[model samples]
Target: MKERMEKRVLVLNLDHTPVGIVNVQKALVLTFLEKATSLVHFDYLEIRTVDRIFPYPAVIRLYEYKNIPYKGVMLNRNNLFKRDQHTCQYCGGDKRLTLDHVIPRSKGGKSSWKNLVTACHRCNTLKGDKTPEQAGMTLRTLPFRPTLSYFLAEYAERHAAEWLPFLEVKPVG
Candidate 1:
């Protein structure tokens, strides 16, 4: 029951654009207060009260359009790891991951999304103090800033498939 309650519910705007994610408790409150409507349910889950059982809301949409600002995803260690799918961009290793600058900071590369990538300890050491090209190494994927939809789509794929249809970014092959 506790674990189930921890599941996140997708919140969408009146126009069906994804706005944010809320825990089940907050989602229930919004629905009960008529601020939002449930659009999808987790068929295998339910919320039980003293005498009633409600279908677990997997997605909800607000009754009114909330003018939410679109702040970009935060750049941090965790987000960087997520963007790289936890694999080394240089060698594709999944362990001992570290951040690597495609262009070393020694050469004035800023720690921005385009300049950073995930690399294993070995790869980082091998490419130390030099750019990938200078070290005769190549990145498997170019790093880029991830949009909210990109991160949301990724989470939806793993924890909430119901949110997938409402998310703008679709899964690729």
Candidate 2:
């Protein structure tokens, strides 16, 4: 039960902008060290050790503001699939997916967000080593870097809905 409660915790920067997710144990350690404070607890959940009882933290904020240097999300295969929601940018196919360069690398297109996209094996093979334009394919959407808030919000999704207000950056109806 204790281990289960220690599984996840949302961590926020001093500005109240979410930075990432951490385990509840890490959150507790931060709170103990005066490095962070709990913002809220999950309903009907508590952590009890031999010494005392404590509320199970759902969200926590750091005491000091760290620049975190704006090095955005990594440019990698898994991130590409996640950014595109596992759908082929071309033809919208959903199986045997692979990465495709919008402007083929052979033509000097760097492996960056703007140049990369998710594509099913069929589309990838059909348009091998050529620009999508040359292969007569159309991208469903242009790929770009997701905002930090949006990226962290995706991680918060596995937690409680109460986290929505804390992670909220963009307007929602």
Candidate 3:
């Protein structure tokens, strides 16, 4: 099956400071219809705004906006494995890894971020067709969907380190 086009949220800031990213559809609508100005970077647009009037127009000012394209979903196997550095969840060893359904598929485990984990060949084979409880294995941490902010922070940390100074991310803990 063909994969669906991934939608992105645009990160915006006023007065060269951090704000939040809005859905691309919303951003575009605001830009085209609402006359929201776009923030231009070297070659890419860093952000766009819903409001256009500002103190300055040419330089990055209080009314200025930038767009940071939205990154993919965070805290899935991609995020977990990225966070875990691709080590086997069961052994913490560097080896070939596969996805383990925390709840076995036979038990109505749907393929989703909350239901999948990284496992080594041994763990996957040993767990075989059985639930973690049945296999006598325990998960180190429960899987969950990460909030948009969490993923945004992660994306900024990895790709746009300089953005940290501009963005204010509220601490989750």
**Candidates ranked by lDDT:** 1, 2, 3
TM-score of candidate 1 relative to the true fold:
0.87
TM-score versus the correct structure, for each prediction: 0.87, 0.81, 0.49
List model 3 lDDT by residue over 1-173, tens digit each: 01111233334455454346554445555555644564532134333347662221111222445565645355455776754447776677668788888888898998877788788889889999988788888776666554455556666676544345445455232
Model 3 regions lying over 4 Å from their true place: 1-10, 13-80, 162-173
- Is 2 or 3 the stronger prediction by TM-score? 2
Question: lDDT per residue, candidate 2, 1-173, as tens digits?
Answer: 95576557888899988788888889999999999999988877888889998998888999999778777778889888887889999989889999998998889998888889999999999999888888998999888876666655666676565577787545232
Indicate whether candidate 1 or candidate 2 has the larger TM-score: 1
Summarize candidate 1's per-residue lDDT along 46-148 as a digit string, tens digits: 9999999999999999999999998878999999999899999998899999999898888999999899999999999999999888899998988888887
Each candidate structure's count of clashing pairs: 0, 0, 5
| Best candidate according to lDDT | 1
Weakest ten-residue segment in model 2 by summed lDDT:
164-173
Query: Residue 120 of model 1: what lDDT?
Result: 97
lDDT of each: 0.92, 0.83, 0.57
